[model samples]
Target: MSSTQVLNHSPFRLEGDFISQLLTNIRTRSISWTSFVKAGCLSNENMSVLKSITSVNDQEDPLSRVDVLIKDIPTYSKVLFDSILELSNNNTKNLDLTKILLVILYDGLTYINSELFESTITDEFFKISKGNPYPPFIEILNSTTSNSNNDDENNQDNFIISILTAHILTSLLTTVPAQQPASSLDLVSLLFKYIQINLITSNKLQYRFLGIQLLKELLSIKSFRNIYISHTEYLDSLINIMLDKNIELQMRYLSIYCLWTLTFDSKTSQLLTTNAKYSEIIPSMFKFANDAVKEKVVRLSISILINFLNTSINSTNKNEIIKKFLLTNGLTIIKNLIERKWSDDELKEDLNSLYELLNDSIKSLTNFDEYENEIKTKHLLWSPCHKNTEFWYDNIDKFKENNWKLLKSLVSLLSDSSIGDSNLTQLYINQSIICYDLSMIIKVAPEVIKIINTMGTKTQIMTLMNSPNSNVKYEALRTTQLLVANSL
Candidate 1:
């Protein structure tokens, strides 16, 4: 699993009505605001049932819980959301109030319904669609007065504002439907400007990750993608980070995912292929694909190339760009990548898809006459394996290499708990593809089978054979058949 995937899914749902209830209960019972605010929602034992309700994973009762939260939360109306928003902006500069308000707004907005958001919440939180709603917090952050004793508190305040702002932006992107006018490109740009200034520009790595997290979310929406159509600065920043080896691994991976997101737009793709600076860095991305540390980055790097190729399919200058890509050794790189041991069938599918695209394009460009000659001469052979082997020798063998290290890398991936089960499924599917490919390769080159056995590859293959997924089992069986057939 990639860094982008890990951060995209929200771990907990925040209930608006529950928030309102806590405030109302505090007021009715004459509790002190400071004490209640300090206690926070987590400290209330009496609200355990409500907390439990919120704790129930949406996956367990998707229709019931999610629907109820969406429908019931709006009944409290904008009063709760507005109150929290106003408190966050209050001039008193009480750190406690700011903290509590930030907590409420961040949690509630993260999971609110879009219709509710557009109709009742936008004006209050954003001060009419065109205004800067975060000035007060930003003032505190930009202030030069740094007390040595309170430095930790000040840092905490900045971190809260950063996280809270990101969650607000993410909630808007999440709830606002693509067709709604509230999700205007201008509004997205305004919020992104804050993100760029406050989070992306910060020297702190935490702020960079948070900013990129919001970038990943916004680009998930097609309407929001228009914000980057003419604006290449975001693309430039993400690329710079991806190329920086000094940054944390997660930050670099998120940058790669952000670039992948932009490829969905033609303008971004055009800039990448036609723009001088971007075009220069295109080859370096392929090197990142072959990096030994993580398979996800390699998968993402190839996926980015695929997007670039897809974008070039129709352009008048398609051949020119294709020639550039080939000069970068794109064909040889992908062929060797395919030979790498994979833990996910989907990634293998991606590798195959890229190979197919590259192969078909190259054939269209170079083999038009050969194809015609084959038809005229009726020279095609009936044997499947023989022709396939010959094709590998002619085109693929020039890049031919063993993947003993790929096997070791994949085995290490099985123990990774960082990525969710969905990613694990992809890893399983990828392993299946590698097994199937190895089986076919062993048929033509029997010598490689000894290498596979020596690497203790059979143990891993048998483990895949026992997998519950039918697709994985079928591939495992086919691989076993090839291995046994060669030995006999």
Candidate 2:
């Protein structure tokens, strides 16, 4: 049948005969069939199957077919789900059929009322997860093929099914009431069992990534972390993966987020910092901070370190941790990052926050000048050979080129005095220097004010309007006027 004919029929009129034809096509492997049925079209059976299949097939856009079905005919979703589950369970060796069911199930499960489905099959789901094949849900549906030749296909099928199953299970658990116990078998435990099995043992990065991604989702569930924290291995796996330089960069990036979530809990935070096995994880994170090649990875690593610094621990313990962070050359690295200008606009605030935190941590243990002066020497802020520096030296002609770099560096240092025991005189002096640089850039640069405004140095400059120093105050007022006038 043509798609036009299918699409033209009214929803109320599209049931009996058309459904039988569609089912017949599906059973007979018809080229145009979008779904299947096992027997004669009893009116109710045909209606249920027809509604779902037609919902999927009549829509011109395949991408949105299932979404329409869920939104418009949600009451019929279970009927659609039951048909696939029954077909797959009834015929085990048909890999082709199983794959078809998987795709349909993936779509439906993604948008269906998960709590309704979970309640109906909670016991069966728990039973399915209990044995040799890790994803028992798929195993119960498919009997093993005896031929050894299809092992590769079977393994591939199993991996996809396993990942799909994890997603389905996680979704189902979403609507479960907080007061209700997950299942006869704990759903979180089942999830972690598979996560650890796949994450720690698999050599493949894809599998490991899938496992970490699942863990990230689980972190959204209120009680999921309590279960996760109980199992030390889960925590260990995350830290180890994050620190392993040999692992894929994306995988390591995901692990950093997962670890960051764990640090929210006091117990998890202590475990991460105090665990002997994870000694290298924290240090390696600082190393990541020093390397700006991967902007996201560096930012996330720095964020996790900030969380550690914010984690509540005894003063002596905190000092020891700071000392460990210092040993990683964290102080030097933060200094280096502060000196180099970043091109990505998104990274500017995050980079500033990292520098501020590391600098604060250092000062808490000792004086600020020792680290502050050392950081200043690293930046070529005063160099006459501007071409040799990162930005704003020789490009007297290109205000676009030099203006941003000069502004960021000035703001970075200006923010330095804002962090700790402020020397007003030093800050005024610092503010005077930055305002001087700002005034000079405005004279030569065309688009510079917007960048300065967008970079958020404008507000800091506005604060300087009240400065005690007349030169600093005059420069601040002039810079503010220029920025506001440029915007208009």
Best by TM-score: 2
- TM-score for each predicted model, relative to the true structure: 0.52, 0.53
Which residue pairs clash within candidate 1? 343-427, 343-431, 344-426, 344-427, 344-429, 344-430, 345-429, 345-430
Candidate 1: minimum summed lDDT over ten consecutive residues — where?
A: 372-381
What is the alpha-carbon lDDT of model 1 when measured against the actual structure?
0.56
Question: Please, what are the lDDT tens digits per residue for candidate 1 over residues 1-488?
Answer: 12221223343232234333433332233223435335452223323322332344442322322333344444332334434444445444455444444444444443334443344343444434334344433333333122212347566555554455456545555554443454345557765776676667667766676777777777777777777655667667777667776887777787888788888776678778776556445676678787647988887887787777678747665665665555566777888889999997888998887677667677555332232222222221122322355644453332234554433433344333432242566565455555665665566566777777887776777777888878778888888878777878
Q: How many clashes (backbone N, Cα, C below 3 Å) per candidate?
A: 8, 1
lDDT on C-alpha atoms for all candidate structures: 0.56, 0.56
Candidate 2 lDDT, 288-321, residue by residue in tens: 7676377777767777776676775777666666
Instruction: Report RMSD for candidate 2.
Output: 20.0
Q: Name the lDDT value of residue 100 in candidate 1.
A: 45
